[model samples]
Target chain A: MTAAQPATGHDHVVVAADVNGVSVTEPVPTRWTLAQFLRDRLGLTGTKVSCELQVCGACSVLVDGAPVSACTYLAADIDGRRVQTVEGLAARDQLHPLQRSFVEHFALQCGFCTPGFLMMAKALLDRNPDPTEDEVKEYLDGNICRCTGYEPIVAAVLDAAKRMRGQA
Target chain B: MVLPPFALHRPTTTAQALSLLAEDSVPYSGGTELLLAMRMGLIRPTALVDLKRIPEMQEIRTDRSRLLIGAGVSHDRLATDPLVEQHARLLAAAEREVGNARVRAQGSIGGNICFGEPRSDVATVLIALEAELGLANSAGERSVPAEEFFLGPYWTARDATELLTAISIPLPCAEGVYLKFQTVERPTVAVAAVRRPGGDYRVVVGAVGEVPVWADYPGVGEVDPVDLVGRTSPVSDLTGSERYKRHVTEVYIRRAAELLAESER
Candidate 1:
């Protein structure tokens, strides 16, 4: 344990966290959002940012396995926490089950919203590996997809759930 | 849009937190509402005293005849906590539907109350349950009923120097149904009709007005939807016309009462 430092009006604070299984520590602006920290600072551009307001799940990311709106979350607050983004889904040379399911089910059209959808769905599956269609819809209601009519997205999640459970 | 720069402080104790609070240095818990306000330029604070690290602020316990919920507890926790579910089932039901999964995981009950959002499900249910807010400042601590804590939209009874510490609901709290007419993120009209322990009935209508409007009845038959509708001040907005909101307010009030009656059987 270190001695308590005097509180200062410094705009930047050192943030230490495990991002996508990699430990990252850097001085971040007090106002820097988790989205900015992931995209601009760490180059984890897989997380998208739109509708900075939390209404749209375009900026959804997992903080300690719970979904959060990264655009509005302070990067400084991620200290000593774990963050999982879309980039964290794959294990080099292989698409994650969710990503593979999305491709097979054609869950994405424009693909702009795919990362967000994938991440949010992953968060849900992480908690409830087997989800009914209605449960998946309820969980993903906060996320928006302007393509594929959301049916395939729902199907993809169900399929991914089966794959993860060794029933596919 | 980036939030305006502000100094941040993390305090572990209530006394330390109270000493750090000032007019410009505000309590930041969840950032679900405060950070959004900052981005919209609706509020600008020089410093943010982050309260998430406080141990006492995250506890949920029963004290005598009251169920004490820590101010920093998230909506998700409230929805699932055994004590809250057992003692205040209506609150748990309402908590389950607050915002979405992310908001539920991130937003704090204290932040929800302190923000004083008129369309808040938690506030309407708490008011119906007759929950009391525990507040603290450098001078001392105080308690305010949920019904009186919200003065108006984005306005609360809490002083700038005070921080909400816990929400205390009387044990054997009122049990009922919370129904809302929501087509958007926020509810258009939310109604909570509950039968308290003493055989009295309460119906609180919120979101369709500047603040939640409630009434008490001696019996389920005595609950009047028309009278409750007359009390609300629903304004015409994107959700619905004032007349439309009034119509739904009456409808939801009646439906809530009906459901509450059915639950008793």
Candidate 2:
């Protein structure tokens, strides 16, 4: 009784979203999560869904510059909104400052949850270019990393913020 | 996808939304809680009336001493809205104590209160502040005091046909704070206390009872946190034993009261 099978009789919703600067409109199952739409429909596999529940930060994505748990956010509701996934962080040739800093500081081990961390960290830096260590720790209460004791992830975010502000 | 298939209804106005309501229809605010429950197959509503498009329910309007908080306001908005920060600072502080930045960005005050989750920090503060809830339905709009809104965990006075539109908080302008014991998104034991100069004293203890209990605060400068424990009847869950939760509830109450008292001087 716990595992939910899809409700059989349903129509679909048309979702038009600006994903990573590309605009697309597609008919989606009303129940499909934003994470699923990103990974399945658009084939943007960078957004990972580790714990489908919002508990894990593995599926964090930015909707209009605010970090949201994409696994729980419905694709149908994201209409007319801009969604930025980890795939959008980098240009064709250059890595985003956050991505470069993550690589420079070796922030990931399994590399599965890196996208979520990057996007969440991006929002944090956008608001406060220089955050205290405790502030960063508190802001990331929902985004969890099972590897590296989070020291390097914290260091990488600080470094990225410095690089973004041109203070590095 | 974890969520069961359903039709999505987007209505721009409250009356239009009310017209679309049915037994199997559920109102979607931020979809933070609704989507989570839907994914687990716990709730299978046939249709979801998305409330985000309703402009009337999205304003945080300040009229003199009272502030009308739209139910559609996200947790982050409640936490940082300038009017909330200036007028109902304690409620603002409580919003911050909710889930982290990510959760706050998507969770709405309406869902938080309408869902009537006993462990919700916002609910505790609202009860302590003597807040009133604005509920709309096919008939008309009515106001229910925050104290009378909750019946139990996951249960509220608003029927399926009714929608929670806004929350009105009387400007207590009191020195107040909400303190909680938590290891995750929900609090294990939370307490909200407010002390207004030459006005009133109130306290609410939660996460330990069926619904957060509003305790009778003793007069000015007199506080015994242990007194709240008896009123709450702390329930034992994964967080701790019943006795332990009761103890922590007392501790947090003490801390909250101390903060209130210190501000009075």
Top DockQ hit: 1
Best by lDDT: 1
lDDT of 2 by residue, B1-265 (tens): 5677788777778888888887799889888788878878888998998888889888998777778988899999888889899888988888987887877999899998887777888888888888899888888989999899889989999989999988998874655777888987789988888875446788888777889887655574666666667778777888889888887888888888888778777
What TM-score would each prediction reach against the true structure?
0.97, 0.95
For candidate 2, give the lDDT of residue A49. 88
In candidate 1 chain B, where is summed lDDT lowest over 10 consecutive residues? B8-17
Per-residue accuracy of model 1 over A63-150 as CA lDDT, tens digit each: 9888999998999888878999998899997999999999999898888888888988998898899999999999998888876459
| Docking band of candidate 2 | acceptable
Tell me the deviation in Å of residue A65 in model 1.
Answer: 1.0
DockQ of each: 0.70, 0.45
Give the per-residue Cα lDDT of candidate 1 at A36: 96
Q: Report the Cα lDDT for residue A57, model 1.
A: 92
